[model samples]
Target chain A: MVNEQGYNVALVGATGAVGHKMLETLERKKFPIKQLTLLSSSRSAGKKINFKGEEYTVQEATPESFEGIQIALFSAGGSVSKSLAHEAVARGAVVIDNTSAFRMDENVPLVVPEVNEEDIAKHNGIIANPNCSTIQMVAALKPIQAKFGMSRVIVSTYQAVSGAGNLAIDELKDQSQAFLNGEDMEANLLPVSGDKKHYPIAFNALPQIDVFQENGYTYEEMKMINETKKIMHAPGLPVAATCVRLPFFTSHAESVYVEVADENVTVKDIQSALVNADGIILEDDPSTQTYPTPLSASGKSEVFVGRVRKDLDNAKGFHLWVVSDNLLKGAAWNSVQIAESLIKNNWL
Target chain B: MVNEQGYNVALVGATGAVGHKMLETLERKKFPIKQLTLLSSSRSAGKKINFKGEEYTVQEATPESFEGIQIALFSAGGSVSKSLAHEAVARGAVVIDNTSAFRMDENVPLVVPEVNEEDIAKHNGIIANPNCSTIQMVAALKPIQAKFGMSRVIVSTYQAVSGAGNLAIDELKDQSQAFLNGEDMEANLLPVSGDKKHYPIAFNALPQIDVFQENGYTYEEMKMINETKKIMHAPGLPVAATCVRLPFFTSHAESVYVEVADENVTVKDIQSALVNADGIILEDDPSTQTYPTPLSASGKSEVFVGRVRKDLDNAKGFHLWVVSDNLLKGAAWNSVQIAESLIKNNWL
Candidate 1:
């Protein structure tokens, strides 16, 4: 299958939300592909997905599915990635997993192309995509950390339901309809699908994103805290997060406060640094009433930064508003970008 | 009207949102009222509102409206408050203003009864009510500050549309309906009614609240910062805020980070302090998955505090989730409390 034309690529979880985005991103970017294979769990097997007007049948994932595959993208779930990622990697295929399965693995490299693309070369056939919230946040902070040097980062996220998966989006829609009709909403999946005591997300905000960990912080908060440290290679950096799920359908917005190493840094200095950063689009100008909103940033690939301001009392403290499409730059696109980097750099 | 039976009360802007709540709260609490005068702008002057099954017609407010008024509660626009508050005071009526016109005035007392009942005695006839966002935050922080002492405070607010008034509440509902129907939304009065641009707030979050100031912070954010210091009597306290408007219709929630002066203070200590404090409700129990949400905290007169946890990296820093009804505890209830304090202390 890989004789000469191009590399063989397979997409697992092809029928899910982020998986659908992966297929579309591949077709839109015209990624080099000699043969395209689609894989999913048994529940979604035999499903049909079309890319570039070509219908493809999704097959159940198995160990032998990656026999001749040169690259594989995984987005099904943590257990699927844990079981199949190693099998795909053992068969000479590079696995770019979109779950938290291998992110903290000592041998696995957690990659955000805009932040840590160079780490792609050191991956031993498996690179983990960071969390959606962490991806946008680290992308915005990369330039600031590089130019001014960062000591502390405190972020509070206004995240979307889509990050919880396609079912959560449906829940939001159903709850909104019920709310408008003055009926009690039936809640099944929200705040966390695995957690108990579900609450409605229509016209409301839930402070807990993922399940609460032992330390009172949710797992989503921990992901942002740990992934930022690992991606930036600053394990000692002080990072804290409070992740809250809002009623939006897509795009996650963050209010971030960072303390720069240099005390003389100003808001203009930070804005100018982010203006030319890759994968970052600076939209801050209070005079023109310009800033990024979740609706405006939906379906966009670039991380939009705005509301840049200096903390009134602290010379080194500054605040930023960062927004990006959760499915694109946060998951599917980041995974694809890593694969693209691997091919371009001859690292695979 | 000043006979031994009761006192005459004038409710300015009585047909408006907060004004309507003020009237309901006055009637609900069975305040001593020999006579009630409902006042509004020229447009809403002829409207009729019922208090205790008695309908009163709203009259156009003027300088002479306060001639026989023992207490005047002003919930009109800041300009109206600026133009009429002093006139009410000059006619021997103690003015309880719920607008921002006199909040920062050194001669006036910005009162949150639980935190600063003594400040009511210092009022030069006009006792200003703090901004809705500030009122809940300071009330939550008052107990913590009293026990451990606070050196710094940083807050990010998730505000409701009702804080912007009744039209903004209507905008939220209309936009949510439009969003569900797959139609375009019309936003003419949000983020700030007087701001340059309006964005759809249905299923979205806007970081800007009120108009932008010279610095990147909004006037709403500035009010929280300045008002917190004045009401706490800690002029040197370092406070910063990022105010955001969400699509919800009631109850404002805040994610607050405070640096307690005592390094050994723990989450339990703070929770215990709040459990016994006046006008504070402690709803924190991570094991039971209990915390406050906008829908859960709506229509409540007490500030709900929960999600108390210590910062993972800082021993002196703690985080809290504070929620309260924007129209009740944040505005109407606080104003009525000030009047009760004035009456109890014989300051009127």
Candidate 2:
């Protein structure tokens, strides 16, 4: 199917929430693609998708589906990526997986293009994207880390329901309407679909994101803690996270506290570092009541930073409010940027 | 109207949210009241409030409103408290003010009955109820600090829209309905009612809580920091807070990180401390997806503690999720409890 004008690219999980954004991002960024194949699970197969005024049919993915594919983006689920990512890689395709499958495999490079693009070059045919919560925190922290060394990080997140998937989005919509109507709000999926219990996410906050790990931290919380150290290349960094799912449908907002290694770093110093960073927008001005909210950052690609202030007691400690569209910069756009980086740097 | 059986009580801001809750709590707790005087601003003066099967008319509060008032509970705006609290005290009334007007005044005691009922005895006529967000956090941290001695505290709050007042609750409800109807969300009051800019709180998170202070922190955040030190009697304690307003209408949830001074402390130790502490509930069972959420804790009087986990790197540090009904424990119930202590201990 290759016309030799550009590289052959295949998108796995084309029916997913992140997948929908990935396709849109690839088209908007004008990614080099000569032949585009859409793959999904058997349940979602035979679907039609319109891209750039062209209609494409989705097919159930098999190992043979990746033949001659130069680039593959996987985001269906962990099991799907676990079973099919190697198949795609074995077929001469570089995989940028958005699941937690091979992120800590030691052979894979976990990357946030803005934070750790150089690690993409060392991928063994498959690169891993960090969690949505981790991606935004690291994107905002990288600039500060580059200018002033960071000693510790503690973050608490207000995440969106879209990160749970499309069905979860539907659940929020239904529940919000029910709650507004003074009716009983029914919940089928939230907090986690596979978890033992489901809680309502409309006009409420759920403290759990993923399944609880053995060490008392949720898998989502551990992913944020471990992924930040991996992407920043500081294996000994002390990071703590408490991930809570709010009722929002788009962006994830985080309250981050960082202790810098350098002495006498003021709030101005932190603002100067983030304002000039590659993919960050600083919107902090308390006098004008200016700051980024989930609604304001719903569709933006760049990470938004605001509410910067110094810890009243600790001279080196600073607090920041970081917000970004979880589907865009957190997953889809970050994955597409990795594909672009591979082609730009001749890493593939 | 004073009788020999019970103390005469005066309720300020009788038509407001906290004032409504105050009436409900006083009735539920069956506080001894021979006569009740309802007072409010001029706009709400004629509003009729039903209390204990009797209808009471709210009167415009003046300097003479507290004449023979044994206990005057003020929940109106800070300006009303600043102008009338001292006048109420001058008339031989014990004022329990639920505003920031006298909280930082050295002569007044900021009281959370669960943590520091003894501090109520030190009040110079006016006892200040700590901020709602602060009351819940300190109630959770007090037991832990008493058991292991805390050194530093970092908190990120998921506060409800009702914390801003009744109009904010209406704004959230109206905007949420509009958002669900595919209409634009109108914003008239949120983050701070008197602040220059108003952001929509429907399915959104606003980082600013109270008006911003000269120190680049919100007045709400500063209240948390300074009041925590004062209530805990630890002047050198390092406390940092980021207060964010979410769309929830009732309860406030907090993700707290505390560094205990003890050499070694486990999650079990922390839970045991909270389970035995007064006015605290331990609802942490990760295996069953148990945790305290805003919706679940909306009407509860106790502080709900869950998701207790030790830090991965520091053995002395721990993280906890705390939730409580802002109107009850954070405002009305707490203020009423202080009044009860004043009567029970004969401190008035």
Candidate 3:
């Protein structure tokens, strides 16, 4: 199905949440695609999806599925990426993975287009998109890092259920309705689906996001800490995160505390740095109560930064509220942007 | 109606959210109330409430209402407290004001019974109950400060709508139902009802909890910062707060970062400090996914501390997740505890 006008692209996990957003982002961005092959797990195969006024059948993804593909966007899961990303890469496709499988891989480049677009060129057949929480934090941090040298970061996240995937969104909806009705809210997919316990995410806050590591930090917290340094290329940055899942459905909001190396950086300087940044929208104005909330930034691709304030005690420290749609700039659009960069720069 | 046994008590704002909780707490704690006077604004007057199988009608509060009141508990708005608190004190009633009207007053002692119970003795006719978010944090931090010698604190709050009182809670319920039913979520009160703009708290997070100060920090954020210092009696403590309102109905959860003066403290040391602390329940065990969440901590009078971890980069720093019922330990119980302390210590 390869055509002469554009590159043939294969989208893995086309039936899932991030995958669905990827398709919409590609269609909205008018991504140059000659042949679009939708791939999913065996369970979701044969489903019909319409894109750009054309119906396409989702096929089961195997090694052979990437035969003539020029670009593959993998978001099925970490295990799927581990098994098939290399198969796709070896068969002559640049893989932009949307899982944690290759994010910390020494050879793979962890990329956020707004933070580290040039890292896309250094990929050895595969590029890794950072975690949803990490992506938005770095997008906001990069502008500040560029304007003033950064030192430390401490973030506490108010994350949405959608970052956990489609089931979590359904669970939040079901549980919320159940809670409103004075019924016992059933919990099967929250805090972590694979973890030993399940807690209600409706009208509650779960401090644990992913499974806990040996150091007592959740994998989601570690992802935010590790991937932030990797994408920003600040290996020694002292980043700490406490990831808490709130009942919201879409956008993830982080209360970030950063200490810049420059002691003279004021609130205005931080606001000015974010105002003209590529994919950042500075919505901070205390006088007007202008700031981004989950509902306000749900469908937006740009990272919204607001509530900028200098630390009362530390001259070099500043606090910011950063929010972005986890599915858009955090995952799907970032993946597609990496693909666009690959083609535009002839990195493929 | 005055009796010979126990102190004569006046309950202001008896029809409001915190006021209702205060009644329950007084009844549950078996506080020695010889006579109870229910008072509210003119709008809420004429309402009836039951206590210990007795029905009492609320009256409009005036200076005369506190004629024989030995102790007055105030949970009304700040304007009401500002107008009537002095009048109650002038009538020989020791006022325990839950509003922010006198929290920063140099003459008024800001007391968190667990942290600064002795400060209640220094009250000049009025004792200020610290903010809900501040009460839980200082309750968790006091033990750490006692054992480890605290230095700096940074907190990001996951606050509930109940902190805004009854109307805000109703807004959340109505808006959440509307959002689920695919109708428009109306917003009349949230992120400070008195503020110019109103944001929906249904399935959303609002970073502003109170009116913005000139320094760009919300009044709630400033309350956390300044009130924590006063309650902990550490005025020089470098405290910063980002107070965010979430969709939950009770229990304010805080992600706190603190640096102890002792650099060699381990996670166990921090756990040990919290394990035996008064009014604190340590619920940290990452292996079993044990942590304190808003729902788990809701309706509890004790502050729940969990997810305790040593900072990877800072030898002297630690992080904690703290949660408590905003109406109980954060408001009603704390006020009642102060009254009990006053009675026990003969401070009144």
Which candidate number has the best DockQ?
A: 3
Compose the digit string of candidate 1's lDDT tens values, residues A1-348: 223477899999998989988988888877888889999999999999888888999999999999999999999999999999999999999999999998999799999988889999899999999999999999999999999999998888899999999999999999999999999998899888887799989988899988888899888999999999999999999898888899999999999999999999999899999997999999998887799999999988899999999999999999899999999999999999998898888888
Candidate 2: clashing pairs of residues: none
Candidate 1 chain B weakest ten by summed lDDT: B1-10
Q: DockQ of each candidate's interface versus the true one?
A: 0.79, 0.90, 0.92
Q: What is the TM-score of chain A alone in each candidate?
A: 0.98, 0.98, 0.98
Model 3, range A76-193, lDDT digits (tens) per residue?
9999999999999999999999999999998999998888889887899999999999999999999899889999999999999999999999999999999999999999989898
| Deviating ranges (above 4 Å) for candidate 2 | A1-4, B1-4
Candidate with more favorable, higher lDDT: 1 or 2: 2
For candidate 2, the per-residue lDDT at B259 reads 95
Residues B261-325, candidate 2: write the lDDT tens digits: 98578889999999999999999999899999999999889999999999998888899999999
- Residue-level lDDT of model 3, residues B296-331, one tens digit each, is 998889999999999999999999999999999999
The 10-residue segment of model 1 chain A with minimum total lDDT is A1-10
Scoring only the second chain, what is candidate 1's TM-score?
A: 0.98
| Poorly placed runs, candidate 1 (over 4 Å) | A1-4, B1-4
Q: Write the per-residue lDDT of candidate 2 for residues A1-348, one digit (tens) a residue.
A: 323488899999999999999999999998889999999999999999998899999999999999999999999999999999999999999999999999988999999988889999898999999899999999999999999999999999999999999999999999989998899999888889987789899999999999999999999999999999999999999999999999989999999999998778989999999999988999999999989999999888999999999998888899999999999999999999999899888898
Candidates' chain B TM-scores in the order shown: 0.98, 0.98, 0.98
